[model samples]
Each structure stands twice: as structure tokens, then as C-alpha cells.
Target: MAEARETLEEPILTGNGGPTDLAAMEPDLLDVEPDQTVASGRRRRSFQFGWWLACGWLILVVGAALLAPILPLWEPGTPDYTNVAGGLSASHPLGGDAIGRDNLSRLIYGARASLLVGLSAVVLGAVIGGLLGIIAGYVGGKVERVLLTLTDATLAFPGLVLLIAAVAVFGASMTVIIVGLAVLSIPTFIRLARATTLVIVQREFVTAARAYGARPMRVMLREVVPNVVLPVAAYGFIMVGVFIVAEGSLSFLGLGIPPPTPSWGSMIAAGRTELLTHPQISLIPAAVMFVTVLSINYVGERTRKRFEVKDSNL
Candidate 1:
């Protein structure tokens, strides 16, 4: 009798596999548990904190880089032989490098190189690529074919090898690095803007503007670009972090800004041999790079999600 009662209490499975009409069969199952609801809320709150933290770090790094010249820090290149490989102290807050140069100072100055390359490359790539992409997408025909063929060809090559070759051939000054990275970035933004423009071109507003006798240039600038820029810009934000890493990598490989100029990557390279004896030398700049990249990516992702939500709502 007890076994029969227990069997009858079990909810019947539907042909589709789930419990049949869960609400009718067991109303309690449809209701969310309190713990789950609270846990979800906590996760959302933690994400909010993380987003703000990421934004804060970016702001701090940018501000520090911009004001580095005026700040009363030791010159990045000045070395103290007596304090070689010293740990943290009043004079060297973060400590000294293998050569006794101020690690903190080098780290700050290095931000300039990283930021300069990252920002300039992305902006250049976006402007050039965005224009070509808009023209190709809005004026589809032979123009689209030619442009896309070039972009696809560029994309077909191995990116890192191409970058290395370009840097090697052109010489690895900051300008060469910036331009090389910009060229590398162009194909991506071209495809992104092209896809976005294609979507915007079909919209009712674009059609209405066209019907109102707007010139092609005006239509592209006023109608399509405004809609297309948001997503491209969002993607570009993420690309900034990537370009920073690229710049760092180039520096590490001796293809970036030369030594005595102080770059985060070069600092790491300089301190690499002493990693076991003076881990802080390499580790400090590495930590800064890690934080900087992580923060930029985190903020960019949040911005992308926000734009996506807005697009979905529209």
C-alpha cells in the first residue's frame, strides 16, 4: 500500500520528456526557489562592481600616462648603481629594476608608448576602413567587389607573420609599428562596418532619406554612419586592448620602440633574466600590463553588451 502511494505521487513525464504540464502536476516546481533568486541578484551586483572597477582602472591609467611628465617622479632612465635590484622603499615605491632604474617611473613612461600605438592605430584603422566599408556597402556593385576582394586577400595572410615582416622591412620605430598595426586592423573594421552598413542601408529611414533626394555622400554621413558607428566604435574599444598587447609583444620581440626609451614590454624583457632573483622587476610591469588590458577589455565588453541591448530594443 505504501509503495503504491509513493508511485502515484510521482509526476507523469510527457512524450517530449519533461514533466507533463508542470504547473498543473506540481505547481511548486514552477516557482523559483528563494536561494536561486538571491544568488542571481548577487551575481548581477558583483558584475556591476566589476564593471565600475574596470572603468576606474582605465581612467586611472590614462590619467597617469597623460600627466606623467608633470608628475614629480624620477626620470625613467636615471639609474642608481648602489640600489641595483632593490625592493620597494620610500625612493622606489615599486622598487628598482635590474639596472637600478626606477621601476615605477619606467612603468608610467612605458604607458605612453603602449597607449600611443594602441590609440593611434585603432583610430587610423577605423577611419580608413569605415569609409571604404561604407562606400562599398552603400554603393554595392564593382566597388564592393574590388574592396572586399582586397580585404579578403589581406585577411587570408597570416597576421602575425605579416606584422613581423612589415616591421622588419620598414624598421621598428613607433611610427612603423603604428602604421603596421593600423593596416592589420583595417581588414577587421572593413568587414565589421560593411556588414553594419549593409544592415543600415535597408532600413526605412535610409530609404526615406534617399527618397527625399539626399545626396549619396550626405546619406552615408548623416544616416548610415550614425547607425553604423556605434557598433564599430564598440568593437574598436575592444581592439584598443588588442593593439596594446600587439605593441607590447612587438616590444618584447625587439621589434618595438628601442631600449632606453622605456616600454612595458622592454622592461619585462630587461628584467626577464633576473626573474628568479628579482621577480618584481619583470612582474611589476607585467602586472600593470595585465591590469590595463583586462580593464580595457572588460569595459569594452560591457559597452558592447549595452549597445547590443539597445539594438535589440530598437
Candidate 2:
């Protein structure tokens, strides 16, 4: 009797082996038992708390960027001739770089650019690659062969080196940098989306939609895209964290955005010269990057786990 109730709730199966009349069924699909409802609410609260903790670093960096100019702090690019070697104090809490620019100000400003590049690259990669992956997986055969080959070739190159070379070729602007990383990031998203879609396309729900004579495009969009998007979004957070550190590294190497445009990497590179004398300049940015990356990874993993629903054919 319980199995019959479960089957009725899901409506994925019918005694006649035909697609169920979903229009007549209630949209809620499954009814929530009292115990199950309470457990779900508890889980939701736990997830919200985890997100709140994750957003803490995100909020801090964005707030720091927005409030930077208004703060009593010295401008990032302007040199403070009197405070080169001065350790942390009321005026300069993070101390001064070799050029005597305020460390706190530069760190805040660098974050604005670093995060912008990271997030922009992730969105670009996810959109372009996710679309192509969906096409490849749904259409399969010749189309899949051609697109996968191109991605594979791009994947074969040494990523960071290719990025630097591409930057070197394109003149190292923010737009060029984003393109470089997005190109590298596409292959990963392509593989993930394609793998997920292959499984989804074979599901009974997908077959039933096709049996109902729904156009291929409509079925793919209405069915496949929704199911695959959650996992892709979960993975995007990790990509953002990665691209952030990469941008910082490129800046450190002097191939990042040109001077006077504060970046964590360039700041760290500038302080390397004075490391023996004053290590605080580089350490502050490093600490911020470390904490941000760790937080992003933890939150991303948790989100992925929370969304790991086994495909239901009930």
C-alpha cells in the first residue's frame, strides 16, 4: 500500500507503461510527512547557516572595496614617503609596501579587480561551455566528436603558461585575462555537463517527454537544463576561487594588470624585495587569499553534497 502511494505521488510510472497524465496530478508531486517536514526544515536551517558563514568573506571584501575611498585610509597608489619601514600602527594597520603605499588600501583595491576577473571568467566559461555540452550530449555522434576534440586540444596545453602566453599576445588587459582563463576553464565545464546530461537524457522522464512528441529543443531545455544546472552552479564557486588565486599569481609575475592597478599578486611581488626587512606587506594579502579560497571550497563542497539527488525513475 505504501509503495502504491509512493508511485502515485511520483507519477513517473503507470500500469499501462505509458507516460502518466501529469496535468491531472497535483504539482506538489510528493506529500510531506510531518516528521519529514521537520527534518527538512532542520536541514534548511543548517544550510542557511553554512551559507551565512561563506558569505562572511564575500561581504567583507565587497564592503572593503565599496568603503575604501571613503575611509580615512591613504590612497593605494599614492606613496607615503615617511612610512616605508613603519610596522602596523593606527595610520597603516597592514604596514607599507616597498613603494610605501598603504597595505590595507591596496589589498582592498586588489580584491575588487581579482574577484571581478574570477567571477567574470566563471560565468563566461559556464555559459558557453554548458551550452555546447548540452548540445553535444543531446545530439551526440558527429557534433560531439568535433566539439570535444577542440576542448581536448585546449586542455592539453600547460594552463598557466598558456594563460601567460595568451596574455602576452593580447596585451594583458582585464578583458584579455578573462578570455585566457575562460578558455582554459571551458573544458572542465564541458566534461562535467556532458557527463551529467548523458545520464539524464536516458532517464524514463526524458523518454516519456519524447514519446509525447515534444520537440527536442523543448525537452532539452525544460527537462535537461533544470536538472543539470544545480551541479554546474555548485562547481562554479570552486572555479571562482581558483581563478582568484590565478589572477593574483599572474599579477605577482608582473604579467598581470599593469602597475598602479593594485592586485594581491603584484602587492606580494613588491613586498618580496623587502621580505627580510618587513614581511607584513605580502603576508596580509596571502592570508586574505587563503581564507577566502578555503571558505569558498568548503561552502562549494557542502552545496554539491546537498544537491546530490539520485535520479528518480519511480
Candidate 3:
């Protein structure tokens, strides 16, 4: 008992033979928290500036698109022979297209197609890809190998070419476009989810849960999924703009929404012939698409960055 007491009472010594000062060591160990707090605060503040502008643009475009049917705007399909290739005017806010369609009205209506295809494709792709990725990552072995091979093959294919072929075979329709774009998006999400899950599955909490006799599915759903989802979702948000742009490209190439239906891509295609005579016809829709994409990208970038900061802090 005396020897045990002496051993317990002995001061812990450093390599230099000096008694270890636990109090001095505490500040170094705890210093990370305040620095991390400051960094997180800075990151939070960084989200304030310019974010509102991007949000405002999104709200404006979305609101305008949703309210288009009831809004006091001219008919999108109706032609005004008198205003053919006309510039901005009281009767036509943005101006008339080469076919005399009200540009502003068409623009508003076109948003429906663009946003629908963009958002829908992204969501579909994200959900399917995220699930597959999580399953493949957690299961590993043959399942992981097969899934990785499939994803690689998909990624290797030319997206635009695949889209064109699909359009030709399936007929150019919104549903086809959405599905094709979603297919293209799947590989990307799968890659992201798989990578994230691989890291998360190795975390201590996951091991603890498994040790507690939790089922694999339960551990995956409750532990792995919650951690893997945020980054993947953040990335998906950013990809929405990319898909929107892809939809526009399809429309521009005459493989998007059918004619007589207004879409930003179709509008630009229709107005391209009148570029020299009435640049506004093409430029206006093009500008709107540009601004919309820019705003989405800006907001998506901010969201991604915010998530990255959060992950770093964790």
C-alpha cells in the first residue's frame, strides 16, 4: 500500500526530466476550440454579403415563372405581326421575337420548362445516386466493384452524344430530357456519395454502433447516411445549374421542348436567325438564362462552401 501510494504520487516527467505541467498542456489542447469558433464565425459572416442578391434573383425568377399563368402578360404563343422584330416597348416589355411572340411573356413561361427540367432531373439523380452509392460503399467487395465499374462506364460515355442519341430514339420531349439528364447526373452523385460514405463508415461512432449489435442497415441509415448526406446534397444543389445549362443546350440544339412551347433555349434558337436585325430577340433570352444560371451557381457555391466549412470544423 505504501509503495502503491508512492507510485501514484510520483510526478509525471517529460523527456527532458522536468515534471509535466498538465495545466500548461491544457491551454494547448483546448486552444483549438476558440480558434475553430473564430473561424466558423468568420465563415458564417462570409455568407451574408452578395448571398441576398442571388437569393433575390432566384425568388424573382421562380415567382415570375409560378405566377406566369395568372399574371397580366401577353399570350406567349400568340403572334403580333405588327410587332415583328420590334424593340422594347409598352406593348412588349422586352420586345417581340422574330415570330412576333411577346418576348417577356415567352420568357416568363419558358422559366417553367427550364426550372422544371433542371430541378427535377437533379432531384431524381441525387436520390437514386445517393442511395446506390451508400449501398455500394457500405457493402464493399463484389457489390462495390460492380457498381464502380458501372459508374465508370457511365462517366466514360459522352454526355451530349448520349443525350442526342436518347432524344433521337425516345423523341424530343420534356420527360425524355429529364430522364436523360438524370441518368447523366447519377454517376457524379454516386461518386460523391461513395467517397463520403467510405470515410464516414470508418468513423468511431459507426464502430461503436456496430459494437452495440446494431444491424448493418440500421447503422448505415442512422449513422452513415446522416453524415454522408450533407456534402452530397450540397454538391447536388450546385449541379442544378449545370443540369439547367444542359437542358438549355438540348433545347438550343432543337432536341429540348417541342416548338410552339416557349423555352429559353427554344426562344434563343428561334431568335438566332434575327440576330443581325433584332439582337434583343436572341440576346434577351440569352441574358436571362445567363443571369439565372449565374445566380444559381453563386448560391450553390455559397452552400457548398458553407458545408465544407462545417465539415472542416467537425
Candidate 4:
């Protein structure tokens, strides 16, 4: 009796008499588990933190630039010549340098030169290196070997040493300093761009585009270049911080932008002699450089992480 009843029940369930509605058959499929919800919430919070950090640094840089004209800071060439008795007073918040110029004013003015060198070097390096990298990565064979060899040779030299040698030979000026930094940074961009291009060039989409008789230029610009831009942009941000610090160091060592122009590096150099007695002069500019570089590095790290997450999801 038990076996006969089991056979009859199985036939009813297997035939058209079974439940027909899709929603009724799998109700649990639509429900989200607690763990999934918690994980998603954590991801959202992390993304928010990254965005805020990046925005904060951007605001600081922009605010300093905009406030330069309106602030009651000293002119770049103007001499403070005030007595040491007025050290750390309200009139001179950051105190006076060895030459009696207000440290605060010099700090503000120094931002212009630092930012200019950093931006210009990145632009020049990215354009030159990016193009070469693209060509080498796509073409491969002998072309790839030659381009990679050249990049490796450039990378063999320490960046600061190259900058110092170039500046020593050419003399200390803004343009010369920028050129030196740019030249030193080109190899990094080349390597990054070439690697990114190589990965994307072998993708299915690229093969399909080529199969459809797309021109080489069109494939590169429309397909390969767009895919690699994010990683290159992240690298550029990190390079900006490096170039800024490099420019400052060059100026501090007397191999950067010439004096009387109120560069942060030169200010630190000038205040070094008085470090024991009036430490504020040197300490303040050093602090500014340190904070700016740290902030930029933080932002760059966050940016890289965000990009990595996106790539994983894709």
C-alpha cells in the first residue's frame, strides 16, 4: 500500500498537474541574505571615505591658490626688515626668515612655483611617453624590444641625480627645472602605458574591431586608449606629488628656481642658518611641503583602490 501511494504522488508532481507559477516555485530566490546586505553597506562606506579624502585635498590646493591675491601677505620682492623682537607675533604668524621677510607671505607665493613645475612636468611626460608606449605595445616584435630597452635605460638613473646634473649644466631657472623633472619622469609613464596597452590589445573587442577592417588609428584611439586612461590618470596624480617634492628639494639645494622669487625650497634653505634660534622660518615651509605631499599620496592611493575595485567588478 505504501509503494503504490508513493508512485501515484510522483506522477502527479512530475506531470502538468505540478505548480505552474515560477514565483511560487522559488520564493527564496528573491530574498537577500543578511551577510550580503552588510557587505554592500561596507563597500558604500569605503567609497564615501575615499571620495571625501580626494575632495579635501583638491579644496586645499584650490583655496591656497585663490587666496593668494586677497591675503595680506608680503609681495614676493618686498623686505620685512622687522626686528627679531617681533618674532611669532600676530603680524607675522609664521615668524620672519633670516632676511627679515615674512615667512607666511613667502609660503603663499611658493605654492605658485611648486604647482607650476608639477603640472607642466606631468603633462610633458604623459604626452611623450604615452604615445611611444601605445605604439610599442600594439606593434610588438622588434619595435617593442627597442622601445622597452630605451625606457629601461632611462629608468636606470636616479631621478634626483639626473635633475641635479641637468640643472647644474643648464643653470637654475623655472623652465630648466621643469624640463629636468619631466625628462626624469618620462620612463615611468612609458612603462605604465605600455603594460596597460598590452593587456587591452588582446581583448575580444579589439580582435572583433580588427576583424571588421577597422583602421589602426581608429582601433587605438577608440578601443585601446579609452580602456587604459584610468590607470594612467591614477599614476599621473602620484607623479604630481613626486614632482612637487622634487622641485622643492631642487630649490632648497640651490639647484632649482633662482632666489628672490620666494620658492618654498629656497625659503627653507635661507632659514636653515637660523634654525636653532628662529626655527619657525624653516619649520613652517618644511611642514607645508610635508603635508602637501602626504595629502597627494593619500589621494592617489585611494584613487588606485577605487580603480582596482571597478576592474574586478567588470
Candidate 5:
């Protein structure tokens, strides 16, 4: 007992334990709770400025997206033939689309499509894939074989081709697009969850749960899922951006929502016809997509590194 107590009291060390590294890796640490140690103060000084910039941009775009409908925003699809391919003006801040819809309105409403599709697809895929992966990793035997085979099969096809084919078959409705994206995404989640679960299942807590004769479902849900979910969720944040880009691509190819929907991709497609004449029409929406995707990646990368440190400590 003396040895055990002494071991508990010993300072825990990690490879990247320096305050500067911790602060850069997890600036939110300061935001969440106060730590008064000298090391923590040093960490606070070396905080992640880049992450804050990215997060701030994300919050701005998301806020715009969420509040778009409630605000007295201009109508996106209403055509102003006179303003077709118009440059930035007092009335049309970003200018008009091919048919004269307000550029700002289209971009604002387009956010709903891209973000909505991304979030819905990721959640749908994660729920199903995460559950199947946990079962396969914990149970083993025939279940593992079946699950792995299914995941692998989905992964075999080229992602773009698969999406196009799905949309072609199912039609280019928003629901179909979401379903198609979710189908493609499930394999990735399955593999990620399976790998994380495989590592966690061998840990002592899991072994103890089994030894105590806990029901398999109880052990899998209570012990395994909680431990494995953090990384998966971080990955999900990153995947949301990928899904957004993919949806945009489908729309650009005319395989997503039909014209007049104000999708970012469709906006680009419409503007391309007048690219040499009024470049801002296409450029504005493209910029928004680029910034949004970049922000999501930054948030995802930081989250991934933070959790990796946590898992290492455990």
C-alpha cells in the first residue's frame, strides 16, 4: 500500500509536457478551467493564436448560416435580368448571379446546404459505423469478418464515381445527396472505430469488466465506447469539411441539387460562364468555401492532437 501510494504521488511525465507545447496544442485549456501552476502559466503565455483565428472565422460563418433565414436577407433565386453578371454594387454587395439573384443571399443560404449535408452525413455514418465497429472489435469471430468485409467493399470504389452513381440512380435531391455521402463515409468511421476499439479492448479496465461477468453489451457500451469516441468525434469534425467539399463538387458537376438552389458549387458553375466578365460572382462563393473548409481542418487537427496526448497519458 505504501508503494502504491508513493507511485500515485509521483509526477506523471509525458514526452511533450512542457507548458509551451501544451498551450500551443490546447489553448482552450485556459478557457475551460483555471490552473495556477507555474507550468500552466507558461502554457497560457504560449497559447495557440492560430487556432483562435481559425475558430473565430468558423464561428462567424456558422453564425451567419444559422441566422440567415431569420434575418431580412435578400432573396437568392429571384432573378434580376438587368443585374445579371453585375459587379459589386451598393444594392448587391457581392453582385448578381447568372439570372440576377443576390450574391450575398445565395452564399448565406448556400451555407445551409453545405453545412447541413456535411453534419447530417457525418452523424448518420458515425452512428452506424461506430456501433458496428465496436461490436466487431469487442466480439471478434464471424462478426468481425462480416463487418470488415462490408467496410472494405464500400471502400473499394472510387469515391467520386460512387457519389455520382448514387446521385444518378437516386436522383439529385438533398436527401439522396446526404444518404450517398453518409454511405461513402461509413467505411472510414468503421475502420477508425475498429482500430481504436481494438486498442482499448486490451486495456485492463476492459479486462476487469469481462472478468466481473459484466454483460457484453454493457461492457462494450459503458467501457469501450466512451473511451474510443473522442478520437472518432475529432475525426468527424474534419470529415464534415470533406463532405461539404464533396457535396459542392456534385453540385458543380450538375449531379447535386438543381439550379436556383444557391449551392456553392452551383454558384461557381453559374459564374464560370461569365468568369472573364465578372469574376467576383464565382470568386466570392469559392472564397467562402475555402475559408470554411480551412477552419474545420484547423479545429480538427488541434482536437486530434489534444486527444492523442490524453490517450498517451492514460
Candidate 6:
């Protein structure tokens, strides 16, 4: 008993043997709360920047759509019969096309067609390519080998070449354009989805979900797909510009959107004949196309950065 008491009573090493030394022994004596606050503040700033970029693009797109129909802008069929009077005037803000149709009006209406083709192509491509890619990635062995081989074969051909070939065979209608663009775009989505699936399927959460008797579809749709969709969505936005340009190119080649219907591509094609004489006809539509495509690309790039930052935070 004496020995145990002696051991217990032995002086504990306290700094300077002072009661204040107890304060020095406290865990995290250096304050970390400020550092934590700094980190949180940075996170909030990043989130705000990301949201602003995303929402800005969304609002722009929506505004364009809403303004397209309501704004008088221009009359579709009425050509500026008086060719002598050109340039931006009060009556003709963007001037008139070669045939005297209001350039501004046609441009506004053309947005409808351009946006439609872009959105439709994206939806079709994503659905078809994403499904095939997911299946190929998840079901390995012969299935994977077959699907990947097919994807490789499809991707080998140049997109523009394929589009040209399809336009030649099918003729240039909206449906044909959409189909051609979607088909040409599929291989890219397939590869993207497959790659994402390959990584996601191996994650511990997937295994945990599986262990809990979650069905394959549930695991894929609820767990795997949601995580992978952000990249796909970003890619879709990028693809919208590609589709718009492709449609325009086809129209410029005299095989797109049909005559009478004012497509941006058709407008550009019309202006090509008088490119030197009445440059504004072609220049105006080209400018619109340039701005639209540029804005879309910028938005896509910003979206990709935002997602990358978000993933890093996670």
C-alpha cells in the first residue's frame, strides 16, 4: 500500500510546477478556429462564383428564347424591297438580306430552329450513347469488347464527313439534320459514359450499396448515374454549338432546313452570293452564329471548372 501511494504521489512533470502550466497542456493550444473560418470562407466564395457563372448562362439562354417570339425585331417574309437604302436605319435595325427580308427578324426566328436542333440532337445523343456506354461498361467480357469495338469503328470516321454523307443520302430536312448530328455525336458520349462508369463501379459506396441488396438498376440510376451526370451535362452544352454549326454548314452547302423557312445557315448561304456586294447579309448572320457559339463554349468551360472545383471540395 505504501509503495503504491509513493508512486501515485510522485510529482507529475508540470511546466514550472505552476497551475498555469495546465493551460499550456491543453490540446490544440494553437487556435485553429481562424484557419477553419478562412477555409469555409474560401469554400463559400467558390460556390458563389460557380453558381453565378451557371445561373448567368442559364438566364442568357432563357432570355434569348423568351425574346425570340415577342420582339417585333423583323418580319419573316417581307424583303427590304428597296436595296438602295441599306445599312442600319430606324426602319431596318440590322438592315435587310439580299432578298429584302429583315435580317434582324430572320435572325430572331432563326434562333428557334438553331436551338431546337441543338437541344434535340443533345437529348438523342445522350440517351442513346449514355445507355449503350453504361451497358458496355457494366457488362464486361464479350459484351464490353463488342460495344467498344463498335464505338471505335464509329469514332474513326470524321464527324463532318459523316454529316455530309448523311445529308447527301437523306436530303436536308430538320429531322435528317438532327438524326445526322445525333448519330455523329454518339461515339463521344459513349466513350465518356463508359469511362465514368468504369471508375464509379469500383467505388466503395457502390460495393456497400450492392452489399445492402440494392438492385443493379438502383445502384446505377440512383448511385452511379447522378454522380456522373454533371460532366455529361457540361459536354452536352459544348455539343450544342457543334450541332448548330453543323446544321448551318449543311444549309450553307444548299442542303439544310429548306427554303422559305429562315434558318441562320440558309441566310448565310443566301448572303454568300452577294458576299462582296451586300456583305451585311452574310456578316449579320455569321456574327450571330459566332456570338452564340462563343457564349456556349464559354459557359461549358465555366461549368467544367465549377464541377472540377466541386469534386475537389468533396
Q: What would the per-residue lDDT of candidate 3 be over residues 158-260, giving only the tens digit for each residue?
A: 9999999999999999999999999999999999999999999989999999999999999999999998888888888778788878888888899999988
Which residue pairs show collisions in model 1?
A: none
Best-fitting candidate, scored by lDDT: 3
lDDT digits (tens) for residues 69-96 of candidate 2 = 7877789899997778567888888878
Q: Each prediction's TM-score against the native?
A: 0.85, 0.84, 0.86, 0.83, 0.86, 0.80
Candidate 4, residues 80-177, lDDT tens digits: the string is 77834137778887777776777777787888778778888988888888878888898889998998998899899787888888887888889998
Better of 3 and 5 by lDDT: 3
- Model 5 C-alpha lDDT per residue in residues 124-203, reported as the tens digit of each score: 99988888888889889999999999899989989899878887787889998888899999998989999999999999
Worst 10 contiguous positions by lDDT, candidate 1: 30-39
Model 2: which residue pairs collide? none
Instruction: Assess candidate 2 and give its lDDT.
Output: 0.83
What does the lDDT come to for candidate 6? 0.79
Supply candidate 6's per-residue lDDT for 188.
89
Q: Please, what is the whole-model Cα lDDT of each candidate in the order they appear? A: 0.86, 0.83, 0.87, 0.78, 0.83, 0.79
Worst 10 residues of 6 by lDDT: 29-38
lDDT of 6 by residue, 50-107 (tens): 6676567556654765587677666677766883326787888888877677877787
Indicate the residue-level lDDT of 91 in model 3: 87
RMSD of each: 10.4, 4.8, 7.6, 8.3, 7.6, 9.7
Writing each residue's lDDT as its tens digit, candidate 1 over 9-85 gives: 45545567664765555644443233343336777788789998998999988999999999989889999886699
Scored by lDDT, model 5 comes in at 0.83
TM-score, predicted candidate 2 vs. hidden true structure? 0.84
